[model samples]
Target chain A: MAALKDIIARDYGTPAVVIDLDIVTHNIARLQAACEARGLENRPHIKTHKSPELAAMQREAGAAGITCQKLGEAEIMADAGFDDILISYNLIGEEKIARLAALIPRARIIVAADNPVAVDAYAEAAKRAGKPLEVIIECDTGRKRAGVESVADAIALAERIKASPQLRFAGFMLYNPEDAVAQTQAFLDEALAGIRGLGLEASIISTGGTPNLSNLGRIRGTTEHRAGTYIFNDRMMLACGAAELADCALHVYTTVVSRAGPERGILDAGSKTLTSDIGGLDGHGLIREFPQARIARFAEEHGFLDLSASSRKPAIGDVVRVIPNHVCVVVNMVDRLIAVRGDEVVGEIPVAARGRIV
Target chain B: MAALKDIIARDYGTPAVVIDLDIVTHNIARLQAACEARGLENRPHIKTHKSPELAAMQREAGAAGITCQKLGEAEIMADAGFDDILISYNLIGEEKIARLAALIPRARIIVAADNPVAVDAYAEAAKRAGKPLEVIIECDTGRKRAGVESVADAIALAERIKASPQLRFAGFMLYNPEDAVAQTQAFLDEALAGIRGLGLEASIISTGGTPNLSNLGRIRGTTEHRAGTYIFNDRMMLACGAAELADCALHVYTTVVSRAGPERGILDAGSKTLTSDIGGLDGHGLIREFPQARIARFAEEHGFLDLSASSRKPAIGDVVRVIPNHVCVVVNMVDRLIAVRGDEVVGEIPVAARGRIV
Candidate 1:
């Protein structure tokens, strides 16, 4: 059998996805170690990678539970035997309520709610399932995406859930968008005080991100931290002061197929392998080991590389590894990822939760 | 027997991909008619939808041939009996070369080359197969992505292919990235003149994009024009003055899962459905009938929606149909699209050619 790179260049197929298992294992170990040092439980969200196999590895390396954003993701995780999973998003409707009821029998699924409607849905689902489901009042400490802005709103929702025999009041949950450790720590400190003063027993204070994972000292009040992309930090994380490029494990292996212009060369991997994530420190993610090459445009299966002045031009069959701006999005695009370590094919893991956008 | 939306919503399948097949078919027919009126042959590229079923529809509707960017996409088309398919991308490697050679026996396939190294690879593949392969020299008229810059380089490549008994020079191919119709027409005119001055028949002066299709008051001196996204013009094109929003047939079905804050509402569809195509008009794309909702941040499975202050708030359980910013990228993310016709379930088309990142 051919080794990893040789097979990847040939039978691994074109526009295929390859994951370095060793690198991924290293990332898992590193993150788990970091969370453990501060006596914080690591609940890595499945959203970043959305792989059940990867989640199993994280659990093996000592994760308290798994975090999921959607009910679909939670369903997938629960089916895969993940009993302690957190569906960290607002739940609604009869269809979703039914699915949540079905999930309660299989796992310890906790959901986040910031409003009465969501709390009502949880209550109805829990009552239907004949179980008291855990509910965490989500706070908009920062990152104005969702969650209650003030503590009063959070308390009101918590009280409503408390009124229901079907619900159990958990602690508050938040996502800090800031990347710097010091700033994230300071922000979390005041938010913790405010939540604690609510007179409700806020058990688990969850706060974690790939950017703020390393500087988690300031978040001493955090009972648990949630970080996912840290397992496979991409170029975006490297640029955002989250992690170094050396720590990034997942990379898109592409081939230079066209080099007819002075300023541009074309790669087989386009927006499919490398999705458009332009918010990274660099315009696009760093072109690993190819400082001269910059991704200018993405046309689905075609990536336009600006390498006009490079002395060395990649031939038609030359292989190039690209570290995407955001690793999470890249991993989300493929159907499966081949996990390899050197010449040996460690495993062929299906991106099982792929297309689980619901 | 229920409609697509009814079946999916009843199942509470969050974050669904919906396609108006009637609108798609209508769009295809309308665009083909326009191209035919302009005296141009339409070779629809498969990158937009990445569905062999859709490609077959285009071929059935009198498309001269199909255009694809990857070998995998071309192979899928070939399997679907699209014999006269053009792999409008650079063919590379022993594996790809071998695949290219094998495909020649099954379909009338033509591969593009922009460099001499690639020229040699094609020569070797054809020689190995003992089958003469057609070649198109990709010319970068103004896109700055691929293709030779000057006419001298074009002639030089033509000479190389003509010299090789295994290779046959078909013509020239250029993909201009100009947003205006007039600019692309002018660019094509100049490139055509340059190719003609060399005494070479530029049979396939292939240029395709949503913006360039309607801009053609008259056809350039090229035999065929290619376009993919014209079948379903995306938010980018709609914003770029290319196509109207009515021409857009693809959308994401999402529910207002959470309304935690006054300025923030969360939709089940996120970056995974929208595919993070920023810098377009309206920030992201038009949200079906709700023209007021702006996509704040796309979090994998959750689309952060912030409605216009003037528009009514989306209540929990209320569904929103979102027109994606980039349909091509969005198509690659899903496994199947519910093909509908006026709220009726027409068919369930499997996106067979998706995840072909190589």
Candidate 2:
């Protein structure tokens, strides 16, 4: 193994995603420790890295299985020998239902559904497979994306799952904004009371999101914490004060391809690599060496770096590391991530679930 | 071949990029005719489709050559039997220069450079390969992207390319906004005059951009027009009045995974598939079936569909078609695109040049 810089200089190409396994291991340990100290099970979401290798590290570090946002990702992880998978999305359509039923014999799959249309499909799939499927009711706290609106709807969905002979009502799950944590907690607590009133014991009250990682055990009824982006903290995490820049393990190594003028420079990496997911951030990403230079905009293959704010300028051919605004999207863009341990190139980790967006 | 509806019902998965070959062939012929009528060479930029098959279709439709935005794409096209390639980007860094030099023998490689740094790299790569590489001067032309600022700088860079024994100075290229066409034409005219004064022929004055496609031969002295998105018009194209909704050839077929409420629904495809590229549009994309429904926002695997505006709403298991705000980024996200003819499933076209960001 050579130094990371040496390996980058000798082997890696420009505009590549490089991951530091040393920091990854540390980040995993940190999150595991946080969950353990708070009496909560840590279910590391695989959407962040989309790598079975990284998910294995999290599981070995004492994670309670893994979480996937889609059935496609879950199928990939199950193929990679990851059991007890939780797909935090409604499995709709006959195709997905049939696929989910087929996946039952391979691993324990827990699904989330906010409506009966999804619940009926899950029931159909479960009955088709002749096996009981675990399901959780998704309650809308404040995310405004997908979830049942009221506690009554949550209880009704729970009853519907309970009524299905092939389905087991696990509990509730909610993904809310950081500001709506208190509201979400109250709704979950009330929903729990309603479910408990039906003589049903809620096994898992799952709450997730990387931004909500810090408030894991603080949410009273949350039995498990699911987080994804903490494995490789990005600029968004840094902006939210959740992680320091040193904790960012994944960085895009891009070369300055064009210094159009003194005020403007262009990097080889752009929306295709770094992504246009600003997420209300100031810029696309953070340049490690040139901290003051703002990534103003991006074309498909060109990242416009505003060099006017910085006294230090990068020359053409100079490779700079960038921590993307959202690391998950960046990981989804590439086929494989360059794995590095400290200052050495470890290996290439295939993003087996990179484009599994079924 | 089975009908597309039948194929999708029996085989295809949700959240897929579907390309109508009928429309693609029509688009190619239409653009080629437009260019030919204007006495301009149509050099189709492969960045939109990122498929060698589609690029070959352009070639068969009478395109002079193919235009790639990166050396990696050029290499892919060359490997796929494309003999003529114009990589409309600066080849920077030792590795890229070496790759470019090696590719010169495989195809007719034309490189674009805005500064001495890129010109010098092209010269070095050419000298190493012991073959003359064609080089073009990229003018800024009010796009504020990569290009020389003034006529003097353009002339200086052209002279530098001409001075290199291994480099051939081959006129100019500009990608300007639709509003900046007149300004860009003025600048290019002056630069062409200056180059002619230096006893240079300036044979290839290439101007490109899908938005500027209507001004194909209107710009005086421009010999070639490079348009990408016309082959698969997107929502942005529709909004910009470049193409009608019917002209959109590429669309994402996504299933409604959750009808969270009466006004809100969620699609399986999100930023990962459709992308978060708003590009000054009202929403992320245009829903073909539900024209009034807006794709409000996106999570990683969930597209938040605001259906308040539409009388008809999508239910769980219902799949809808979406024309993305930017088609190029969507094509880059997937490994393969489903090809169809009218209502029939033709085949799958592998996006061979996709993710070739370097």
Candidate 3:
């Protein structure tokens, strides 16, 4: 593989998301192998890449299926002939339900619902479509974002889904707990037993996050793992000890547009490209070569690069690659990714599911 | 105009950017009136509202021209029949220069540059196009983002632009200084005198920001103002006392997807919709009806609403409006704006210049 600078010089304009296909293939295989070793299904989340081509690669790489966060993304993937999908979000409102109804017959999609309102809506959409929509109860194992609060609540929701004619109670879903893994495991264990006692099969125990990839086998009942950021591991993943810097595949290729002050260099990418998602990292992104240079601030289009600590300052028009704080948001901001193989410009992969926020 | 709730009920799905066109028109006229009363040319920055239609409306309301932060945005506006454009940021690299060369023949474009490197590139592009491109020297008048550090540097840059046969030296450009207006005025006053002493006509003295709109006519030798956020006043503008809550024209219409606990509610919109730009505000956005509910945190597709303080809690599937922290970024996140006039949805306007980072 040629140096990144060579690839950048030969192929890119400024502020492009450059993806190394070699690294991407390696990342997919690594995660897949890890999941397979743990006797777990690798249902790679499509939120990070938002590319049908990339999702296709994951499906081809001994993965169980794909996971999407939104109905719009799932629709795009379904359009591209993805059969099995898990929309890991509450499908709310009448408009979404109508869309879900239309989508039910096209492919196998399992949606996770935490509240009874969402479960009822999914059931309505399923009834309308005349096809049973598989649903998993989102248990609040530890992540207090969205889920059933207790084991009893999880069982109640599972029973509710089982009562509905157009719904199938799949199992339980939880975003992999970071530090409270044991507590979360206990909650899931009790919930699973409770669910099984209700004469329902808890086939899919989906628990995942890129940061908790190391605990794949350690988790008691995690039948499938859903990880998004592992495809293009970023500074956040590196900080969490999930992946190394070399493992990151996606990089924001930007040009130093200004050196207004002796120590301050401004790049063409800012919140619009790199995003303001710091993800508890030091700076907006990590400058690959100029490691000491901090991306101090951002205008809509200008990235303020603080080169005070760095010995290597990027001169005006000098192209540099930045590994962003959160790769998922970075990918969401762009329409396409500049695909590269070493120094060669391989192709352009359209982010077909980009800005599918609904 | 009809109530916002009626509009949401009739016309919106969750996670939509609903623009009140009447309010947008009123906001445009208000800014234009303020600029006109002060004898300043109103060149509304298109970075906030990337729609060519809104740009057209601004032009109709007596704006001198449109200001764009990127070359890609300028191209989009030019394609939509905008002939006079002021690209506020420095256009860097060979690819940008080549595009600028192509753009010169089609439009009356004025570009700002703070350094010799950028000035040289503009001259090269002008030379390639066989046209004299009007260039302005950006002076660091306290806003310290991108500009020449001193009056002497500004004069030197102006001279460099003047020396090039293909370039015409237009005046100076400065982002409106907030509290340091007196010092910035002194710098600009000296720079203006210095440029005039060199037998160069400083025709355009551009200084602007929505926050500094109150200081419009107070600043000496200011010919034009560039403000973007006023078109769709956000919580940032409201916090700065630049706008009233009623003055806010654009809002994110979202649905309450979950009520995990009695005090906790989660909306379908998150960082992807509302964005992570807090702009030093309290929360991610202001819930219109439930002012006490804080947008505490965000997952990729879920907005955690802290409803502990709010008396009015949104029920599941209930659509609500959100005024984002920074409106400019919120506009950039979506593809189209749901244009409304009270209860009636006028049309869907495509954000033609969205994600034009380069």
Output the number of the DockQ-best candidate: 2
| TM-score, B chain alone, candidates in order | 0.92, 0.97, 0.97
Worst 10 residues of 1 chain A by lDDT: A179-188
DockQ preference between candidates 1 and 3, better one: 3
lDDT of 2 at B342: 85
Model 2, span A269-336: residue lDDT tens? 88988989988899899998899999999998889989999999999878888999999999999889
Q: Candidate 1 regions off by >4 Å?
A: A1-7, A13-16, A179-200, A308-316, A342-345, B1-8, B177-203, B217-219, B279-282
TM-score of model number 2: 0.97
Q: Kindly report the docking quality category of candidate 2.
A: medium
**DockQ-sorted candidate list, best first:** 2, 3, 1
Question: What lDDT does the true structure give each of the candidates?
Answer: 0.77, 0.88, 0.88
Q: Give candidate 3 regions above 4 Å deviation.
A: A1-12, B1-12
Give the least accurate 10-residue stretch of model 2 chain A, judged by summed lDDT: A1-10
DockQ of 3: 0.66
Q: Candidate 2 residues B1-358, lDDT tens each? A: 2245446744767888999999999999999999988899989999998888999899998999999998889999999989878988877767777788799888788999988888999999988888898999988877777888899999998889878899998989988877887898889889988888877878798989888986777789889999999999998899888999778899888888887688999998999998888788888988878999999999988899999999998877787788899999999998999999888888999999778877
